[model samples]
Target: MRTVARVIAELLVTFGLVLALLVAHLKWGTDDYTRRAQRGLSDELDKVWSAQSVVAVKPGRAHAVTPPAPAPAKGRPFAVLRVPRFGASWHFTAVEGVTDADLAKGPGHYPGTAQPGQVGNAVFSGHRTTYLAPFNRMGELVPGDEILVDTATLTHVYRVTGHRIVLPTDLSVLAPVPGRPGERARRASLTLTTCHPKYSAAYRLVVFAELSASRPRTT
Candidate 1:
């Protein structure tokens, strides 16, 4: 009986160690992968923006600049999101779609909504507890904080207006005039959504902001 008891104790200890390792791997592995993806996306954006600087000079010397490329395809990155309140290094590449696979790379832009700097709301979503928890501190955002979206052509600056928690089924929050279904949008806005309360998807935490300024990006 003494030997049997000793064996059981050893087994339990082994199980505990294995569990700890698994948890650590999941937490650290996801963070590492997200950082790698962010770097790659940043590099890609540099190339994209560089390509947008093509210039054609007429015989008389009138130069015409080529327009920026269209938005990237679904699941591809199109912009970089930055919130000053999140810290100096707080930024993420926002992909075009919010699919599970796309989000694993970083925050994702919701389909069918206004693109950044457009007349309507531009919506984005990110994980709260996984995939580096890109929006882990989203709840910390408060009114008047600055949120910036940088595209190849322009930098759209938005100021946080408010935040709220809502059920996952609340599609109204994705409207052209967020939280107001069937209403005409009079202003450009930004909405960021993430799983609420940390480590749980029981609700969605949304941060709303309005475009405060937009400026052309100097090469």
Candidate 2:
């Protein structure tokens, strides 16, 4: 009896140690990823600004115009985002045609969607758990909170209008081409989605926001 009780206590101690290690790893890993993401975002933003040009509109006003040719789709549409309600802000990084390692560092886009301010829906994705979950609090977005997308040409701001909870099979919710048979065609918008119900992927949490305004970035 004594031997059996001692073995059980040892097992419990081992489990506790493992749990502590996991907690520490998650905390430290999140911080490290956050710093790495910030640096990458900043560098990308600088590159975008340097490559873009603005067209003069009026006194103290200028509008971004597409360069005679596109900016080489190598980076991303937006430069930075400001989400005050959720306390989330970061420069947009292009994960298109990049590895999962690149995507894990920051928000990534679903290829083939409209880039920011392109007169169509732009869909972006990020993880709900692990490696600095930037969209973890995405469900808390309120109407009128700013969602900025900075491209080489312009910086666009979006005002979150609504959100929805849908099943995993609801791919129609992401139609960038628009003109669905039954659903109303939403205007130029942004949709953010993640695994719903917390800690699970059974459903999706989606937030929708509409383009509010756009301005040129003054370098």
Candidate 2: list runs displaced more than 4 Å. Answer: 54-78, 87-94, 97-99, 177-186
- lDDT per residue as tens, model 2, 111-215: 666667767777777666655666778887888878887666567888988888988788766786332424544567887777787667899888888899988
Off by over 4 Å in 1: 1-8, 58-64
Score each candidate by Cα lDDT: 0.90, 0.68
| Candidate 1 lDDT tens digits, 42-147 | 8887887778767787887866486857867887778889888878788898899998889989999999999999999999999998789899999888899999
TM-score of every candidate: 0.90, 0.77
Worst 10 residues of 2 by lDDT: 69-78
**What is the lDDT, from 0 to 100, of the residue 71 in candidate 2?**
31
Clashes of 1: 0
Decoy 2 TM-score against native: 0.77
